[model samples]
Target chain A: MENEPIIEVRQVNKSFGKNHVLRDFSMDVNQGENLVILGKSGSGKSVLIKCIIRLIDADSGSIKVLGNEINGLDQEPLDDLRSKIGFLFQSNALYDSMTVRQNLEFPLRIHWTKEERLKNGYSAVMEALTDVGLAHTIDMMPSELSGGMRKRIALARALILRPKVILYDEPTTGLDPVTGREISELMVSVQKKYNATSVIISHDMNCIRITSNRVIMLIEGRNYADDTFENLKKSNDPKIKEFFT
Target chain B: MNPLSTYIKESPFLKEIGEIALFTKRFFKEIAKPKQEYAEFLNQCFWIGYKSLILVGVTGFIMGLVLTIQSRPTLVEFGAESMLPSMVSVSLIREIAPVITALICAGKIGSGIGAELGSMRVTEQIDAMEVSGTNPFKYLVVTRVMAATLMLPVLSSLANAISLYGGYLGANIRGNVSWNLYWFQVFNVLNYGDVLPSLIKTFFFGFAIGIIGCYKGYYSQKGTEGVGRSATTAVIVASLLVFIIDLIAVQITDLLGLT
Candidate 1:
C-alpha cells in the first residue's frame, strides 16, 4: 500500500446539460510520476483537471486525492486539500493587478500563519522566482510580462507551496517552440527537485515526450489508452498512433 | 412546445434572480465568518470612498447651483425670494443631495467594481484565489460591499455640505446675501428628522449599489464581452435599485413621522 496512487479517479462522469464531457473515465496517478493526459481541443481535458480539484463538480464519480474522498468534503477540508495541490491554469490566471511577488505570496498567505509567513515568506517567494529565473521581475506586474514570462511566473506561484501534487492545464499551449521546450525542461527539473506527482493536460507531443513518465490518452471522454510514451508511440492502433504522429 | 426556445427565453432571467438571491445569502454567511479581510477592506475604502470624492462633490455643487437658479424666478413671482436658502437647504438635506450623490457613485464606483471583478472572474483569478485556499468571496465581495455601505453615507454628508455652499454662491450671484445670513437660514430649517432619514436611506443605496455590482461581476461569463455586460448592467441595476430604495425609505420615514 506504500506504492498506492496519490490520485485515484474512478468512473468519473461529468456532463453539462446534454453534453457529456467525461463518461465512465477512470485513472490512477502513482506517486512521484509525471502523468500527462493527452487530448485534442474540446476533449474535456480542462474539465477533467477542474474536476480533480473540485473546481468543477463531477456529475458522479469517486475522486480521491491523498486517500481522502474529494467529492463530499466540506469547504474547510476542501480548502485544506487544495493547499496541498497546485494547479497551473491554461491561461496562467496570474492576478494582473498584482505584482509577481504578491502573486507568489498569495498561496503562502492563505495556507501559512502570519508568523510563519513573516519568517519564511520573503525567502520562499524569492526561491520560487529564482527557480523560474525571474527573481528580477518580482515587482513587475503580470501585464508587464510577456506570455512566456507570465507562464513561468504562474508556474512559480504553483511551485511556491511545494505542493505534493501539481496539476497543469495546457502548460505550453501558446508559447513558441523554444520557449515551450524551455518550459518542458523546467517541468522536468521541477519534478525532480520536488519529487512531486504531476498530472499535466496537454496535446503538445514535444512537451509530452519531454515531461511525461507515463501518458494516458483521453479520447471520446474515456481513458482510451495508457502506457509509457515510447510504448504508446510504437502502438499499431489508429487512435493511439494519431497522437504519436 | 419548443423546449429549447422556451428554455432560452425564461432560464436566464429566472436563473439570474435565483443566483443573486443565493449570492446574497452567501455574502451574509461569509460576512459572519472569522478572520475578516481587514487589509483588503481598507484598500477598498480608499478606492471607493477617497477616490469618489471629487466627482460626488462637483455633481452635488452643480445640482445645488442649478436648482437655486431655476427656482429663483418661480419664488420671485410669489415674492418668496428671501426663502431661497431655507428651501434649497431643506430640499437638499431631505432628498436631492443624497439621491444625486448616490447616483453618481452608482455610476462611478459601482461600474468600476463590476468591471474590475468581472475581468478577474473571466481571467480565472477568482478561481485561482479559491484554489489557493483563500476565500475569494470574503476578500473581494464582502470587503467591497462593506466599504460601499460605510462610505456612501460619508460621501453623502460631504456632498450635502458642499451643495449648501453652492446654494450660498448661487444666492449671492443675483442678490447680495451675506454668508452669515445664508448659513443661518440653511441650518435653521434643517433638523435631525430631515438629515437622519436622508442619511439612513443612503446606506441602503450604497448596499444596493455594492451588492448588485458584485453580483453582476461575480457571475460574469462569456469572457471579455461578459465583462462589458457586467459593468453596464451593474450601473443600470444599481441606479434602479437606488431609486427603489429611496421610494421605500420615503414611505417608511413618512409612516414614522420623520418627514
Candidate 2:
C-alpha cells in the first residue's frame, strides 16, 4: 500500500492528424514522488499531462489517476476527478480579467459550496498567496504584476484547492535565471508543505535538478530513460548525455 | 450529411458553416442545463446593453433625421406635405431603425466579443478554466450570448424612439408642424402590423451577432493575427446577417398579410 502508484499511464498513444506526438509512452508516478519528465521541444510531454487529466483525449491508452480509469469517465465524475488534481500550465494561465484574489478563489468558486467558501475562502486565498510570498499583491491584476509574480499567483491558484497530485507544465521556461531559481525553490518547498505528488514537464536543467526526485527522458515519443538525476548525469548514453550537456 | 460534409470539407466557407451549425446546436443544448452563470450574465448585459446606448441612440437619430429630410421634397411635389411625419414614422419603425441598430451592434458588440474571446483562447485562459473544473462555455460563451440576445431588443427599442424624435425635428426643419400634430400622426400611422414584425426580427439579429462573434473567437488560431481575423470576421458575418434576417422577416410578414 505504501508503494502504490497514484498516476499510472500504460502504453498511451496520441497523434494530431499526421503528427504522431506520443507513441506507446508509459510511466508510473508513486504516491508522493516528484517526477520530472524531460523532453525536447515538440515532444509529447505537455500532451501527456493533458491526457492524464483528460483535457485532450488520447488516441488509445489506459490512464489511471487515484485508482480511477479516466479515459471513459463521464463529465460529472471527470470534473470531480479534476478537482483532486492540480494543473499548472506553462503560460501560468491566470485569468487576466480577475484580480489575484479572484484568480486564487476561482477553484474555490467551482469546487466549494457557498457556505464552505464563506467560512474559509479568504484565509485559503491568503495562505496560498503567502506560501508563494506574494500575499501583498493579492488585490492587484495579473497585468500589473511582473512575469515572476504572475507565475507565483498561478501557483497559488493551483495550490488553493489543496489537490492530491499537481501537474506542472514548463514551470520555469521564460524567466530570467534568478527568477527561475526562485520559482524552482518555491516549487520544492510548496510540494513538501502540501505533501502532494508532482509531475513536472520542463527542459530547464536547473529546475529539473532542484525539484525532481527522479527523471524520465521522453525521446521520440516514448519512455527513453528513467533514473535518478545523479545517475542519469553520470551515464555514458549519448541520448541521455546530450540533455546533460 | 457525412458525404456532403466530406465533399465540401475542402472549401473553407462550407467548413465554417458546418462548424457554426454544430456550435449553435451545442449552445441550445448547453443553455438548457442548470447552474446558469447569472452574475457573469448581468456583467455581460451591462457591457453589451448599457455601454452601447450612446452609439445606438446617435445612429437611430441620424437614420430618422436623414429619412425625413430626404423624403419631404417628394411628398411636397404630390401636395401631401402634411403626411411627412406619418410616412417617416412608418418607414422607420417598420424597417430602417431595426436594421441600422443591428448593423451598429454587429460592428461594436460583435467585434468586442470576438477579440475578447480570441485573446482568452490564445492565452490558454479558456483551458485554464477547464483545468480548474469550470465549464468555460457556460461562463464565457453562454453569458455573453444571452446578454447580447436580451440586450439587442432593448437597444433597438430605444433606437426606434430616438429615431422618431429625430424624425420630428426633420419634419420641423422646413415645415411648421406642431409637436402635438407630429406625435399624433406618428402614432396614428403606426399599428401592430408595422411594429411587431420589426420588433420580432431584432431578436434574431441579436442571436446571429452573438453566435457569430463567439464562434469566430472560440476557434481562433495563429495568435494575434488570429484574434484580429476573428474580430474582423465577426463584424462582417454579423452585419451580413442583419440584412439577411431583415429580408427574411419582411418576406414572412408580407406572406402572413401583416404588411
Candidate 3:
C-alpha cells in the first residue's frame, strides 16, 4: 500500500466556542512513514490528531483513514476503524485499578477472539513487554511502575492490536532526558519493525530530530511548515524559528 | 431575593436543566449505537456485582434487625404484635431493602466506577481508547449499566432475605413468634405483585447509578479535580435518582392496582 496514503486529514477546522483550535489544518501520512508534529502547547497539535481519530469532531473538512471517510461513519464502523489504530497518550493512561497484565490485555480481550485472546495473548503481552524492556514486571500495577515503565506499558498496549497506524501524543514528555531519548529511539524502532505509520505529537526538538523523517508545525491554528527538519530550520519566518529555538 | 443570591440560584438551576437535557441526548445517542460491549458487561458484573456481595449482605442484615427492633414497640402499643412479620417483610421487600441496598451500592460501586473512569478521562486513557478503535462508551457505559441493572436486583433480593431473617431474630429476642408462623405471615402478604415491581424498580436504580457515574466520569474535565467532582456527583445524583425512580415506580404500581 506504498502508493496509497494511510491517513489523510484535509482542510480540517475545529473550534471550541470562540477559540479556534484548528483552522483549515491539513496533513497526510503514507504507509510506514513516521511523521512528527511539532507545536508549542495550545498550538492545536493534540486537537489536530484528535480530529484525525474522530475523538474530537472537526467542525469542517475531511479525515480519511485507511481509505474510509471517518467523519460520516456510525459508532459500529467507527469502532471497527478505531481497532486498526493504536494511540499512546502523554500520561501513559494505564488503568490504575488493574494489574499491568490486565492493562495490556484490556483491548485484546475487548476485540480479539477468545482463543486468540487466551493463547496468543500471553505471548503477545510478554513480547510487547520485552520489546519495551519491561518483561520482569508483568504482574505489577500501573501505580507501582515508574514513569518510563508506564510509557512502555502504554506502548505495549498500543502494539497489542498490531495496528496499521500508531499515534503518539507527547510520548516522552515527562521522562528524564535519558529516558526520553530511549523512548524516542524505541518509537523509531517500533515503527520500523511493525512498518506502521506513526504520527508523533511533540514540541521537543531532540525527539523530532531523532525520530521524524518529516516534521509538520501548527502555528496560529493552521499548517505553518511541512518539510524536513533541515528545511524547517532554514525557513525565514521568525515565528517558525522561535518554535525551533 | 437579593440580586446576587437570585442570580446564583437561577444560574445553577438553568445549568442543571441544561445538563439534564445534554445527558438525555447523550444517553439516547449511546443507546442508538448498535455495537454492545459484552466482555465489558461481563467484567463489570463481576466487579460491581459479585465483588459487592459482602458489603450489601452485611448492611442488609443490620438494616433488617434495626428496623424490626425500632418498629416492634409501636406495633405492640397498638396490640398488633402479631402483625410484625408481615409489616417488616412488606417494608423490607417493597421499599426499604431495595432503596437501602441501592444507596449502599451507589456509595460503593458508583463512586468507584466514577473515580475509575474519571481518572481515565483525566489521564487521557479514554482518548487512547478512541484512537485505538475502541468505543469507550461501549466498554465503559454499557458494562457498568448492565452490571448495575442485573446486580441491583440480585443484591436487593439477597438483602430482602437477610433482612427478613434479621426481623425474625429481632422478634424472637422478645416474644413467641415461631419461625413457621413468621414465614407464614411474610409469604401470605408478599405476592408477585408486591415483589416483582419492587424488583423491577431496582434495575432502574442500578441503571441510573451506572449511567450517571460513567457519564460524570467520562465527560470530566479539569484533570484530578474533575475526577473528584465526578465521583461525588455520581453518588449524590444516583442516590437521588433511586428515590425519584422509586416514587415513580410506587405510583405506577398503585395506579395499576398491583399493591
* TM-score for each candidate, following the candidate numbering: 0.97, 0.98, 0.89
**iRMSD (1 decimal) for each model:** 0.6, 0.7, 1.8
TM-score of chain B of each: 0.95, 0.96, 0.91
Please provide, for model 3 over A1-245, each residue's C-alpha lDDT reduced to its tens digit, 9 standing for 90 to 100: 78478988889999999998998888888889889998889889988877778888899998999999989898778878888888888888887878988888888865788899878999989988888899898999988988998999999999887888999999889999999999999999999888899999998888888999899888889888899988998888898899766
| lDDT per residue (tens digit) for residues B1-259 in model 3 | 9998888778976776577667657766876777677766888889988898898898899988888899899999999999999999999999999999999999988899899889899888787766666667777776787788899999999999998898899888877799999999999999999899988999999988888888788878898998999999989988999999999999999999998
Q: Tens digit of lDDT per residue, candidate 1, span B88-172? A: 9999989999999999999998899999999999999999999999999999999999999999999999999999988988888
Error of 2 at A129 (Å): 0.5
Where in model 2 is the C-alpha error above 4 Å? B1-9
Estimate the overall C-alpha local distance difference test score of candidate 1.
Answer: 0.93
lDDT of 3 at A156: 90
The digit string of per-residue lDDT tens for model 2 on A88-121 reads 8899989898999999988888899999999999
Error of 2 at B196 (Å): 1.2
- Cα shift from native, residue B184, model 2 (Å): 0.6
What DockQ number belongs to candidate 1? 0.87
Lowest summed lDDT over 10 consecutive residues: which window, candidate 2 chain A?
Answer: A1-10
List candidate 3 segments past 4 Å from native: A1-5, A234-236, B1-36
Residue-wise C-alpha lDDT for candidate 1, range A114-202, written one tens digit per residue: 99999999999999999999999999999899999999999999999999999999999999999999999999999889889999999
CAPRI verdict (incorrect, acceptable, medium, high) for model 3: medium
